[model samples]
Target chain A: DTAVSQTPKYLVTQMGNDKSIKCEQNLGHDTMYWYKQDSKKFLKIMFSYNNKELIINETVPNRFSPKSPDKAHLNLHINSLELGDSAVYFCASSLKTDTQYFGPGTRLTVL
Target chain B: AQSVTQPDIHITVSEGASLELRCNYSYGATPYLFWYVQSPGQGLQLLLKYFSGDTLVQGIKGFEAEFKRSQSSFNLRKPSVHWSDAAEYFCAVVMTTDSWGKLQFGAGTQVVVTP
Candidate 1:
């Protein structure tokens, strides 16, 4: 039983294409987060949701949207994906003031 | 305005040698520190964390970190480096003022272990 899991481990699409990544956590946490790791392996927070309520929204492009259907799931959708959007996206979940658990990343490649 | 710094971009060490990765944070209040490791093409895994109580904290995989409030540093140390220990290490801090616990991560340091 994985604590956190993501779908579509690898994604390859041309520029202007739209894509989505799904994440779910079995840990029953109230807070979830999305992070982007660029080619240089520098990770930055993108969005955070607590109990399906949006919390932290970093200075990310508007094309990237995070939707939380429930406390256990958080999905990211990229509209008109660009070359710069090609990177590894990670989903993490945690209790308030607790250590976060990350899921397997989804690597997006923009051709 | 808060930031985490990992001074070394890359480090090379021989197997069985000791390893130390330095981390420093810039925040006014008492900080919550963490160390995470990411293997090639893998997600990050928590190595250790320093919240309170003890200045020295032990973590999984035979790793330990010492937090020095005066220096604003929480450096990770491993007594013996193994080949599997070669990975990118990141230093992060949770802002005390933030209730959601948003983490500020460093640029990460790549460790190369030689046999």
Candidate 2:
């Protein structure tokens, strides 16, 4: 069984469109995170949620928002997607103290 | 601010040869260090992590990392690398600050193992 899973492995959208990526973890972890990997392969933390509560919010634009319905699910929604948003988005989960487990990642292409 | 630095952007090694990837970090206090590997079109996988206790930490896929406080370094090493090991490796550090498990990652290093 996959510990972490993401829906729509690949997403292609036009500029100014709205899109959402869903992530689920079966490891029963309490903390979930969203990370963006740029074209240069630099990974940066975008947001983090613990027990359905938003805990960390980086300097991301207001267009991007993350929602956690429960401890097992965290979804990312992008509004008016721009060309710069073209990159791979990764979903990960971890317990209060341990290494994070990652999903298969969703490659987002904004044209 | 905690930061990770991977000086070598790319490294090539022959199959069955020993391999080493250097990672350096800058932080005010002892930080939690980690090494992760990412295959093409895949999410990053945790290789090893150093929290406390023994500096040497062993991980899956025959990978291991050593944490040196004086040098502020956490270097990953493998006795013999297989061709399948060719991938992009990332070094990361987590600060003790109560920011809800924030991790600072390095630029990453691409490893190419040839037969």
Candidate 3:
């Protein structure tokens, strides 16, 4: 069984289109996060949720939103997807400790 | 603000040779540090982490990292290299807040192992 899994490993959408990526973790972790890896391979944290509460919201554009319905799932929704948003989106979960388990990233390609 | 720096953008090593990847961080207090590896087309995997206690921590896949408080560095080292070990490695630091775990990552370093 996959500890952390993301659906639609690859997403290709046109500009101005809205898309959502789903992430689920079975490790019973209390915290989940969304990270974006740009073309330069720089990973940046966009959002972090602990037990369905928004904990950290980095300097990300308002177009990117993260929703955690529960402790086990965290989904990312992107509105008005632009060319600059073409990158790999990774979902990760961790307990109170700093060890994070990452899901297989979803490579998003916005045309 | 907490930040991580991986000075070596790329490193190449011969098979069976020793390897080392340097990671430096800037933070007000002692911060939690981590090292992760990402294979081609795969997500990042935690190699090891340093919270407190011993400075040296061992991880899976024959990887180990040493945390140096004096230098504010956490460097990963391996005794020997395998071709399968060629991948992108990242160093990260946790934000110094009481909130849940949130990580700030470095740019990452690409490792190329040659036979």
TM-score of chain B of each: 0.98, 0.96, 0.96
Highest DockQ scorer:
1
Model 2: number of clashes? 0
* Residues B1-115 of candidate 3: C-alpha lDDT, one tens digit per residue: 5678999999999999999999999988878889999999999999998888999999989999999999999999999999999999999998656466778899999999999
Ranking by DockQ: 1, 3, 2
Give candidate 1 misplaced runs (Cα > 4 Å). Answer: none
lDDT of candidate 1 over A70-105, digit per residue (tens): 999999999998999989999999997689889989
Full-model lDDT for every candidate: 0.94, 0.93, 0.93
- List fnat, each candidate: 0.81, 0.73, 0.86
Best by TM-score: 1
Decreasing lDDT order of the candidates = 1, 2, 3
lDDT of 2 at A58: 96
lDDT of 1: 0.94
TM-score of candidate 2 on Cα atoms, chains taken together = 0.98
The TM-score, computed over Cα atoms with residue i paired to residue i, of candidate 3 is 0.97
